[model samples]
Target: MDVEDDNSYETSTLQVLELKTGDSLRDAIGLLYEKNVFGAPIADVIDSATTSGNFLDPYIGFIDFATMVLWSLEIGELAKSFLWDPFFPVHLNDTLFHVLLLLSKHRIQFVPVIEQFSSKVIAFVTQNAVIQLLLQSSGLEWFDSIADKPLSEFRFENDEHAVHLYGDQSIAEAMHILWENRIGAVAVVRRETERLIGCVTRSDLHLLLDNDDIFNNRKSLTVEKFIHLEASKVHSDPTIEGDLGALLSAGILTLKNKFLPRMDSPVTNRRTDTLKQTMKNLAETNCSSSFIVDELQRLKGVVTLRDMIVQFAPPCMDSRINGGGFFDSALEQTGCHIEKGTLVSDH
Candidate 1:
C-alpha cells in the first residue's frame, strides 16, 4: 500500500474507532476487545467526529492495552499522564517505504497516518499489521532471503537477557516490571528449576482489575496466583472461552491446580527456530512474544513483536536510522529512504 496514494489504506472518518474522554474504564476495555483492534484514537468530546486536530497527543497516544494498563495504575480514569511514548506520525503524503522504515528500522510500534496540517488521524500502521504484509510476501525474493534464515542468524539489540519472574513473585512486582520497562509481557518460570511455565502480559492485567478483591489485593498475590485466576475464568465462563485452551489448560495447573500454559508446555521457540515458524506460533496462539528455550525448555531469551518485525524490514537508504547497518546488499535492491517523516514528539 502506497502511503502517498489516497486510495490506499483509506477509510472514512466515520469508520475510525475513537474512544472518548468520558467513557468508563470498563466500557473502554469492552470496546477494544470487541473491535479486535490494537488501539484506537481518543476524542476529547463524547462523540467527537474529529480527533487530535493538528496534534497526535491524547488521540493516538491514548492507545490500546498498554495505554489503558498504564492509565489504570495511575487513577480511576484516563488522564494525560500516561500518553507519552516514542511513536512517530506520518502524513498521507509519506511513502509506504517511509512507514516501513519507521516500523522496521526505528522499531516504532505505531505510525499514525494523518492529514498534514490538521493532524486528523486516518489510521495506524503497526508492526503486527506490517509483519502480516511481509508474511503475504512469502516466496518473494526479498522476504524469503530473511524468512528462511534461522532466528540465530539475526542479532537482536537486547538479545542479551529477557526480563522474567519466578511463579512466586508478587503480581504487584510483575506489574512494576512491565510498567517501568514499558513492555507488554514477561516470562514466568518455576522457582526451583527456572523452567518456563507461563507468562503474564499487560493484557492479562485487566483480568485482575475486573475483580475488585483481586485488584485491591494484587500486592499479596503471587504471579502464579494471578495466572491461575485467569485460567479459572476459562473453566467458569463460557463467553470468553473460545480456543483459550492454547492459553490455559482444562487440566489442573500446579500442586494447587492443573495448568502449564496448556497442561503440557509453554509457547516457545528455539534458537534454531526460523523466523517464519515463530511468526506462525505467535499468530496461531495470539501470543505477544515467544520465549526461546533449550531442549529442556528452560527460559533463555524472548522474541518480541518488535524483534520479529525488524527482521523483515528492508535496509534503509538513510544513514540516519538508529541502526544504520542493515543486512548485506539488500539496500541496493530497496530504495526511497527518507531522512525523517513528520514525527509527533512525545510531550
Candidate 2:
C-alpha cells in the first residue's frame, strides 16, 4: 500500500463531545451515555484578544467515562464531582503510526487530536477505526497465521489474575472492584455455582448516572439488580410507558426481568479457539473483549483488544518500516520505545 504524508490528511468532521472544565462528572457521564461514547476532550472556556469570536483554550486532556466512574466512587459524590488531569493528546498532523503507538502505550480506546501550536483539539481517533483501516489494507492475510495460535499462548500474567464480582454484591462494591483493578469490565458469577451469569462494564455504570433513583438508592441495590433494571429498559416497549410505570410503582421490577440480554450472554470463545476466529467474533459484535472459557463454559481469562493489538505490534512495525522512509519517520516521531520493531512493553 502507498503511504501518504501527514499533511495530506484532513481532520475528521465527526462532532466531538467537548467538555468544559467545570462540567460535573455526572453531567459528563450522562452526555457520554447519550452519545454512546467512551470519552471526550476537555477544553477550558477562554477569551482571545485578536478576534471577536470565542475560542476555547488548548484542551487540558481527555476524560474517559471509566475514569469518571472511579472518581465518583472515590469521592462518594457524582453530581458535584469533576475530573482532574486527563490523558495526553496527539497532534492533528501526526501519522496513523504515531496514533497507534500512543493508543497502545496508553491502553485507551481513543486519543484526542490537537492542533500543533494552539493545542486545541480538532478531532479524535479511535482504536476501532484504526483496526478497520488495517483490515482493509494489504497484507491483512498476515493475521491469518497469527490468529491460528492458541489464546493461551497470548495470555499474560494479568489475564491469569482475572478479577470477578458476585451477582449478590452491591453496585457500590462492584464499582469499587472495577475501579481498584483498573479494568473496563468484570465477570459476574453466581455465588454458589460460580457459573458466569453476566458481565458488568464501565459503560453499564452509565445507567446509574442516567437515573437518579437508581444512583441514590445504589447502596441497597445489588449488582444483579442494576443489571436487571438496565436490561428491562433496553427490552421494554417504548410505547407502553404505563406498563413500566406500573411495575415501578408496584415495586415488582426485579432481577427476574433478566439482565441486559447482550451483557447477560457475554461474547465468549474457547481457550483453544484460533485468534483469527476470536478477532472475527469481536469485530462482528464491535465488543472490546471476550471471556475466554473452558470446555464447560467456565471463565478462564479475558481477551481484550489491547492484548490482541500488542500481539500484532511486531508484524505491524515490520510492515510500516518496510513501507518506505515516510512511514519510518512517522513511527520514529511517535517517541515510542521500540526494539527490533515490537513495542518495548505493555503500558
Candidate 3:
C-alpha cells in the first residue's frame, strides 16, 4: 500500500541510530548521552549517569537515580522497529475520541506526522499533548462530563517556536541555549534543514548542573567516556505495596536519598477490574494517568485522572457548568477519598 512516490517516508533504522544498523543501541545511547536526548524516560537516564560518582552509597543515603540508566534496547533497533510507524503518524489536529481510537489501536506514545510533499516528519503528537487538549476542551474546571462534544474544538494551532541545539554542539552550549531561552526543553535539530533530530530536556541539563561538569574541561571527555561515565542507567520499577501512603512515602524517601526528582511511574490494570480497584490505583499514585497497554507490552491508550472526574462528579451530571480547575476541589467536595490507601468513596 506504500506509494513509492508518496515521498512521505519509510521507517529507516539507520536514520534512527544516526548511524548504521550494525551499531549497538549501547553505542547510540553513549553517543547521544555525550550530546543530547530528551523526553521523560531519557531524563531518568541522564539523572542517573551524571550523579553516579558522588551518590554511590545507598545505605549512607547518598544514592542517585541517574546512575541507573540502562540501554535496554539499542537505538538502531528502536529506530528500525518501532511499535508503530513514524511516517503515517497521528495527527494532532483530531478529536479526542479519534485520538483515543488511534492510541487504543496503535499502542504508541508518539506518532510522527510527515509533510505530504517532503514525507519528512514535521511534528509529533504525544499522549501528554493530547491530555492537555482534552483538559482544555472540557472548559469545565473539572471536565466531569465524559460524553461532551468532539475534541477538535480544542485542536492545537500555534506558531512554530522551539528552543533548539545542534547535533555536535557541546553540552555547555546546550546549557547556554536553555538558560538564555528560560526553557527546560530544546529540540536537537539538524543544522542544514532545521529539522528535529532529537531533544535535550531540562533533565539532560540537570545532569550538567548537578555534576558541575565544567564546559571548558569537557573538551577532553570523549562521547564514549561521557556515556559510560554518566549516561548508562536502568529504569525504575514501582513496587506495589499494600499500603498507598507507605508506597508514596517510600518512593519520596527513595527520591530524596537518591537525589532524583520524582515522576509518575507506569502502572498496569486488569481490564475487568472493579471500579474500586481503579480508584485505588488512582488515589495512591496521584498521577491520574494509567497507560493501557496490551499483552504484547505495546501502548494501548491513556486514562487521565480528569476522565474519572467526569464519571463521578455530581455537578457534571446536572449541567455543563465550567468548574475551572476544580476537579481536585470537586473530588474533595464530593468526599472522594484521595489519600493513599483509602477505600473508594464519594460523598
Provide the TM-score for each candidate, comma-separated: 0.68, 0.70, 0.30
**Which tens-of-lDDT digit does each residue in 99-140 have in candidate 1?**
766777653456777766655666665444455455667888
**Per-model C-alpha lDDT, please?**
0.60, 0.60, 0.36
Across 43-144, the per-residue lDDT of candidate 2 in tens digits comes to 766656654744434577677776787787777688554545456676654566666566555567656666667656665555544544444443455555
RMSD per prediction, one decimal? 8.7, 9.9, 21.9
Could you arrange the candidates by TM-score from highest to lowest? 2, 1, 3
Superposition error at 320 for model 3 (Å): 32
The digit string of per-residue lDDT tens for model 3 on 173-219 reads 55456555534344454466543444443443334434656434454
Give stretches of model 3 more than 4 Å off: 1-23, 39-88, 91-98, 139-143, 147-347
Clashes of each: 8, 2, 20
lDDT value, candidate 3, whole model = 0.36
lDDT of 3 at 37: 30
User: What C-alpha lDDT, on a 0 to 100 scale, does residue 208 get in candidate 1?
Assistant: 60
